[model samples]
Target: MDSQLHIFFFPYMAHSHMMPAIEMAKLFASRGCKASIVSTPANAPHIHKAIESGTNLGLEIGVLSIRFPTQEVGLPEGCENANSLTSLEMMNKFFTAVNMLDQPLEQLLMEHRPSCLVADLFFPWATDVSAKFGIPRLVFHGFSFFALCALASLLRHEPHKQVSSDSEPFVIPNLPDEIKITRNQLPDYMKEETEFSGFLKKLDESELNSYGIIVNSYYELEPAYADHYRNVLGMKAWHVGPTFLCNEEKEGYKAVRGQEASISEQECSNWLDSKKSNSVIYVCFGSLANFVDSQLMEIAMGLEASGKQFIWVVKKGKHEEGVKEEWLPEGFEKRMEGKGLIVRGWAPQLLILQHQAVGAFVTHCGWNSTLESVCAGVPMVTWPVSAEQFYNEKLVTQVLGIGVGVGAKKWARLTGDSVNREAIEKAVNLIMEGKEAEEMRSRSKALGVMASRAVQEGGSSYEDLTALIEDLRLQRHCCGSK
Candidate 1:
């Protein structure tokens, strides 16, 4: 194996999953390595954009397609294409499909004969695939270290013992940080002894104990978790992240719409452009979070009463038909005609957040979204909707002190499913106009600068990336003696 080499990368089949892998791929390719982005055919359209961007920029990057079972075991024909499913459900199906992928992945490895395989944590067979070819395997956890640490902790417990509803913080053993979380905040599968829990636990144990684990977080923000993985867990792990900064050259690039017009990207920029500087409250719950009728109504009423200019990017079909403005106060849209911008489909999130007019983010607190918010130097109102989002909320509100949460503890709703209009107004007002908001804004901006520095030439994340490559080089050399 050569230090200057080709590598294969597999991102789990989701936009959030794909973006992080693409970010890392760009980084590796820019560093004189060729990268083949191994993914399913369904993810081609979205990932093709990323692949094209990397290759056209003169980085050696290519797309390698994987096969999906003709009949999905637990989903509809086009379930993978639909963005409506919850992240937990998505992961459940995705991990189940991993068994089907082994053949295709193995074939690609034999054909490409890459130096290493850098794959998403969902795919347990990546380590086996690397070993078969005598190559190093780097398992990338495309999330914050906190979530990775949580997953590692979840793996140590028996499947039957994991679902206990004790009203106490389940402390993660052997971690440097006392990041204690309640049972309610655990991954959805671990909350109960369902089929999903048993299957997921098996996958975690197999992958978590791999030769190396790579997390999408910088050392400074998660020094404790990073240190734990390296020291206590005694695993070869790398924290090369604040991943967006991996390519400053690609910062200005936008997604080019080719064929699938399912997601529209029109006038979203103009809408953000019209809002007041640092005055618009941008709300998006990522691609997966779906709200029930009552929750939807409550959120609408809240945004209406807040009286601040807002850009609410509602997902398509999130709520029932005829409930768009019907759920809000009468004439609310008319009242805030120039002030409110409701983009119902995909909006350019990074561009919108990075805009000068966008002030506070009313977010679902997904790790990728959380990191993007922090990197954009925007303070947040963390309205965590599901899964590991609650833990992310804890990190933002408690550990980082850079955002406000909608709940008191893990999974506790600030208001019931149907929050009254007044509570919404107050939450928005607090984040947008209060002294606390300004303090968070200042701290978030400072952290953004630090995050940027972390990926720079001599920065923490940069050195980590360099170290990972150097270690792989050493591992390859050592293998010759065997």
Candidate 2:
């Protein structure tokens, strides 16, 4: 402990991975550990802002840069932007970059000689590199503890064997709660055999085999799943999440893009402000979740039926083919007039979620959005599009009991035989403004308090983080002398 304990951190190129890693770095700095983060040159600006924010608050965190091919293989330049490309394409490109990252990352490790490394999902190769350098590796899963368990179960069973690819309820054998998954709801990439599934499989296995694992979750939020990690997986893991606690002064904090509108911010927030408070339904399927026009029309009609003020952020190419607002209820916009704002581009989500007028969120239930909604003290209408979202929907509706999930019973689009427009309208109504809605809102507020407390000093997350740092340093030293 004489010299600063150097800890190297590397998050996957996507924003979801990078944000949690940055928060973890802040925690390390707060506890007197020196953090050196690694990322591609394109990602450097993001890390720079995160480091700048931490340094401004007297946290000691440094960043190291790595070079990635601007367009590796088939990925285009700036294809790593999470807000743009599909998740599968991003994964293929990202892991391709990971394979190439070893040498430069190795060079940094040799030069810095950090006590340990914290790596994100999708970098299973980190284990090999850590072994080479004799440094302990801690893998971070940026999703729910439940999702981790579900994923583990999927990998263990390899369910593609039991049911025909064309069948329904595609049961994942030997998991609790009769956990049934469908083909369409499986992660977009996992729908077929390809590089994406292989990459994810490697990440899952690497995480299970890592020296230690850390999740951006809390015991209170996911006690049972945390127990599963400890008893079943036999991995020393830490659940420290709702990282929003790091943002004490919510106001004046810059959006992740760092700029107001040019090139990144995209004027999304200014449009949101023009709508009425609690009257607008904010819809974002997250950085991923492409939609066909028919599905998009269903959503638009559902929102229209609610007749509530609304602000919608539609991703590029989300609408169904040949579909437009012409399919929307006639006179809808004219009726709502100044009440609705729809931006067909990138949205300043954190800012929008935190806005006082914003009452509810319709999100894909990504951990980032889950935590952000809690931090903003806003209720959510969970519309988990795919992957672990089914588990997340469970947490939102069954476990937390604070939010309404459109896909609580099923994970596919509403158009399928499973659910239709009536069901969609009903779920939306129950969540947006209905008899049970206020009680759900109250419950969400209560959970927000618990979420905040988990990240504060002496809280579960704080204690777990401390334990992780101590254990990591000790393990790294023991491995070094061997």
Q: What CA root-mean-square deviation does each model show from the true structure?
A: 3.7, 4.3
List, residue by residue over 1-482, the lDDT tens digit for candidate 2.
34567888898876767877887787788788888888877778877876665244667788788877656556777655454455555655655666887888888888877888888766788887887877878888788777888777777776855666544677665444455566656654555676666778778777766788888887777787788867886767887776646754544453652222221344556665665666556777766566666666677777776766677777654446756554355666677577776666566677777666777888778788887776676777877765577767767777667688665443443222233456567776787686677787777777778878888889998889888877876776676557
lDDT of every predicted structure (CA atoms): 0.72, 0.70
Candidate 1 C-alpha lDDT tens digits along 44-96: 76787766652446788888887676366575555554353555566557556
Off by over 4 Å in 2: 71-74, 82-94, 164-167, 170-179, 188-193, 254-279, 317-334, 407-422, 476-482
Candidate 1: what lDDT? Answer: 0.72
Q: Which residue pairs show collisions in model 1?
A: none
Model 1 root mean square deviation, Cα atoms: 3.7
What TM-score would each prediction reach against the true structure? 0.88, 0.85
Best by TM-score: 1
TM-score for candidate 2, residues paired by index: 0.85
Error of 1 at 399 (Å): 0.8
TM-score, candidate number 1: 0.88
Model 2: lDDT of residue 408: 40
